[model samples]
Target: MEKSIIIGLDIGTTSVKAVAFSRGGRVIGEQEIAYPLSTPFPGWAEQDPLEIEAATITVIRNLIQLPTIDEKNILAIGLSTAMHSLICMAENGEPLSPSITWADGRASLQANRLRVEHNHIYDLTGTPIHPMSPLVKLIWMKENNYLPYQQASYFVSIKEFILYRWFGCQSVDYAVASATGLLDLHHLKWNKEALELAGVSEAQLFKPVSPTEVLVDLDKTIADQIGLPVHIPFVIGSSDGPLANIGLGAINPGEVAITIGTSGAIRQIVTEPKSDSLQQTFCYGITESLSLIGGPTNNGGIVLQWLKETLDIKETYEELISVAEKAEPGAEGLLFLPYLNGERAPIWNANVRASLFGLSLRHKKEHIVRAGLEGVIYSVFHVGQALERLAGKPTTLLASGGFGRSPLWLQITADVFNQEVQVPISHQSSAWGAAWMALFAIGEVTDLASIKQAIPMQENYMPNPDHHKIYMDLFKLYQELSHTTHSIYMK
Candidate 1:
């Protein structure tokens, strides 16, 4: 008796991963292929699309070849890609420029300009006026007369480019399109004014499709390269953010998903399109009837990495965290503003820099390490605050990502947000969500709600009563210091 398996392919900023899962939601095998993100100039983060495509094919091939994986029993493969990657494409499907990722800040000037005059677009599209938005990126290209922009026949995301190369079609899932700042959330189509604003037309973008849309008949060459049948169906899963919520089984009412990887986000599923008046959050479509409202922070685990390197700490991450756990809450009045990588959501400013305030001679290596970790979770809490403002308070806070591996990190998150945080047995939420989407697309699963039952969970991290009060008081100082720092950049 062969076990049925499905593979989920995640196209992330710096790597591509394929995870094989059994029908029961247990992992069968997995493989990951890494690539480099080139920064030719300041504020420019780009990747060679062709190189990424090679990695993608290699990762899938390697995953299928794992001893535990029976390619013959493979049912389907689904996609979950990071959002806001823009690539200029030629008429013949070749890339005119490298894929500009979400971290690129080259469009900060243009984004700031648009933020003043055309702010209404945020209400219409549900994406903030940030450099991460492809629309803002396009505006920068158009204004500066970038050569690639002039030569491009079409604009597409990395996922769409891969699909075009494999399937010879220019198609984008609704969730990725909504993050572009060019899709009409209410109408679920490319916005005419947004196109006119970016100096591109509807003809220049990929045809928007539902996330559950099935793409079949993989290119025969690619199919042979991966040793899979050409007719195997591929479900067009949503962006990593929305799919992560599904992966963590956080779609039920009052459940919010918080993921902290290299970056972080806090998202909640909503019945209809919702946007905050302050433009603090984005609403990306998941299905025709459902959407995800959330905010993303550019800083997360990267801040801790930066701190560890700056202090010349040679200890492993686990050891450093163990030392940090010794420090009491508040780190004895040492607070850090984790804007080392600029910022997104709530602030929407890319010029803001990092700062360590309230530093005193009493602070030691452990205190600094603890404050650094606290600062990272505080950044997540900052985004969660904006999420709450838009979608109201969450009853359950679900935590995922690299930070979740540390009990101290989860406890800090639970304390700062003053909510119980549930950790899933598997940290591969995006990949799992993509696998579930493949099941739903093939009619093997009844509905999205059924995934909640398949996922295994551990005991919840409850908020500490004593620590919560200290954090709340310290959070006010964090809020004040954040505003002061942002004001300096804005002025």
Candidate 2:
């Protein structure tokens, strides 16, 4: 008997993952491969787009090639990629340059100039003007490294690279387009000013499409290598973060998004073409019915990963969390500013560096470690405040990402935000979201209300008043130090 399976490929900043599942969303096989981010210069982080392409291809090929997997029954392939990171390829679809990752800060100056001149990078792209945006990265290339955009053909996000490998087209899912900071957040199309600044034409960008649209025609070249026959179907999927929200059942309005990965973002779902008056938050459409509005911070699990290496803290995450549990709430007044890769969202400074405040002789290694973790989680709360303010109130916070596995992290997140947070029993809500999107496209589900009922909830963490008060004090101190430090650093 042939077994049919659907595949979701999540191409992330620090790693690439492909998970195979049955239509009911039962996982059968999975593969995760980490890749290095080359930093040839300071304030710069890049990766060979071809390398990412090859890795995705390799994983998918090996995945479907495994024995006991019936090749003929494979249903569809959907992709979810890290947003903003872009590849500039030649006319023939060959990569002409390394892709600038969403974390790269070399383009901070370009973003700043745009903010000053345009008066509303926020209005144009829903996202604040920041170095993390692909538009800024592209502009940086033209002003600082001009030849690439002038000579190269297309400037695209990671999924376009994957689509080219699979079906030989440069199409983008709306989720991915929104992240580029080039798409008109309200209208869901590329901004003319963004294109002019990038020195590229509309032809160089992905033909924006919906998440549910099947846009790939299995090219024989890729099909033969992956053990799948030619003419198979592929969907130009959406951004990993937004899809994670869908997979987590956080798609509906009033749902706050909290994701901790290589980077983190806290956003809320809205139904209207909403904009944050603070000019601090960005907006993007999830679908005609749902809009993704939130602020994203540049640091998350990366800070934890840094602590693990810096303190020679070779202990596993669980062990580390146990240690963190023993530490006093608020890390005993210690504060860590997570700007190691610069910052985004509310604080738009890119030249700023990471630091620890209130570090003293009394602080132990555990205290230092605990402060780093809490600081990163607390930073999300800052964004959360802006989101809630925009919506006139807070919403049900849904937490996902690799970091959500830690109970301590979840508790701190809830306490810091002073709201209850939910976690899914099954992980990778992005993939789950993609599958649910597939179901929606096929007419299985009409709206998110049904998805809410269908998706299972694992657990919820409520805020502890005592702990919340402690974090409130710490967060106030955090905001003070963050603003003072950012102003000084930028100056």
Best candidate according to lDDT: 1
Q: What value does the lDDT take at residue 484 in candidate 1? A: 89
lDDT (Cα, tens digit) per residue for candidate 2, span 1-491: 54357777788888887777665566777777788899999888999888887888788887777674566767667778888888888867788778888878888788778878875767777766788888788888888766766678788777787677666776788777887878887788888987787677898887877888775468777767677777566666678777887777676667777888878988776787677666777787766566788878888888888888887887896787677777888888899988887887777788878899998888888898789888898888888778777885666788888877888888888888788989876667676676666556645558544566655667799999999999898889888888898899877
Residues 303-399 of candidate 1 have per-residue lDDT tens digits of 8789789989898999988988889988988998889889997788898999888888888988988998898888778878888777778999998
Ten-residue segment with the worst summed lDDT in candidate 2? Answer: 442-451
Best by TM-score: 1
TM-score of each candidate structure, all chains considered together? 0.98, 0.94
TM-score of candidate 2 against the unseen true structure:
0.94
For each candidate, how many residue pairs have backbone atoms clashing (under 3 Å)?
Answer: 0, 4
**Which whole-number lDDT from 0 to 100 does residue 192 have in model 1?**
94
lDDT against the true structure, each candidate: 0.90, 0.78
